[model samples]
Target: MTLLACVALISAAISFSSIAEPLTSAQQNQVRELIRDTLVNNPQILEEAVNAWEQRSTEQAGARLGKIIEQNKDALFNNAASPRIGAKNAKLTLVSFTDYNCPYCKQFDPRLEQIVKKYPDVAIVLKLLPFRGETSQSSAQYALTLWQQQPDRFLALHQRLMSKKGNHTKGSIVSALKSTGNDNLSIDKKTLDEVRSSLRLADLLGVQGTPATLIGDQMIPGAVSYDVLEQVVKAQLARTSS
Candidate 1:
């Protein structure tokens, strides 16, 4: 592989580390030995290997999600909440797991929109992956209720809430929804009660924070610029298309 390819693979390693939980020291040591053996004579891959390891961040080693993004690509794209408008069977799918109250998620929301608009063939799925405290849970419930009960209205509410001027408080969200001619809608105690009752999807994804995204085989945590995201998405799209 070329140097760029090596970097890309190393990036993948970094991405993997962020999504799933970190490996045990023994396991990491074993992987190091394996690379040493494989690259016993190849200095380039050896360097690549070291860089991949050295560059890995703790965020990359999510306990339940680290290894999931790549291993479960097919299911993620075709799963519930996957987009119906974008490329359904396209070579690329970007799944975002975010919190309504997460400031980073707010920052990422627009960048995500631009990415999808730029690559219409890439299907984007937004899953409610809340990992904060009770407030986050309630926000997620409110959002998901909108998605399930008033999908069209829910997306609008979501975008607005994810904006700088948008409000995250319950009263604020309701008012925003009402202004959108959804006055008849209700996210009152009953609705909130219902949303809080069920949240199996979040558990399955093993999300620990807001603004976590699954781009192809990579799970990116925190806010990222379009430039960095574009490189990763484009590389995966190329790999899939190839």
Candidate 2:
């Protein structure tokens, strides 16, 4: 039952109790019958109540997450260790937690590229979360190390990796690295630490899987459509500009 409907029923019972002594079995049955009759005659009440509850719940969750994001702004948006793309001095920034082995993240890569192209003033910080397995971990470490050592070639390699059809193996990662002229790269201890930091940050932000994107205070989970991403970017731009 919806909270509103439950509240209404509880209030009716409370009123009945207050009007006299504790209700007998017969009076309790009467209250139950009354509620059933009301529901039967006005089923729309249930739907309306459910809709209201859902809206309120969504707003509450958003507000709670907004506060959390506000508290961790630096770690999320300005971490120097995180590799960034798009405008260097962007008016708005998006923090993306992604896994190379995740098919969804692969699906999201093209749309992300489009966003970068379409919105020159927006930046995206990439945090590689190796949630899938050892191959995922190795890939993330390689990407991070590459970004640190050779920033200019990182995007090309990233696009190559994300564009791959299935789970990345050691051979595939090396092949992609070679294709992007980053074949000599090696993962270091610092890169592994950065990968761990990314995982911890994802845990802090309640990320359950790949492709969790943070735009402003909202965290969009999974691979959203280009239109949805564009709409959010526009909305955030408007809000920040104002």
RMSD of 2: 2.5
- Candidate 1 lDDT tens digits, 1-242: 54565456656766887799887788678667755654565568767766877667544665346465445555565554432235656668777777676778888888888877788678677765545555566666666656666666666766766763433666766665576666566444544433332234344565566677777546677788989989988998888878
Candidate 2, 122-216: lDDT as tens digits: 99999999888888998888888888888888899899889888899989999998998888888866987788778888888889988999998
Q: Give the Cα error of residue 112 in candidate 2, in Å.
A: 0.7
Candidate 1's displacement at residue 192, Å, is: 9.4
TM-score of each prediction: 0.61, 0.92
How much does candidate 1 score in TM-score? 0.61
Residue 212, model 1, lDDT: 71
Task: List CA RMSD, all candidates.
Answer: 12.0, 2.5
- Alpha-carbon local distance difference test for all models: 0.64, 0.88
Judge candidate 1 at residue 69 and give its lDDT: 46
Model 2 segments beyond 4 Å from truth? 1-12, 15-20
**How many residue-pair clashes does candidate 1 contain?**
11
**Residue pairs that clash (backbone atoms under 3 angstroms), model 2:** none
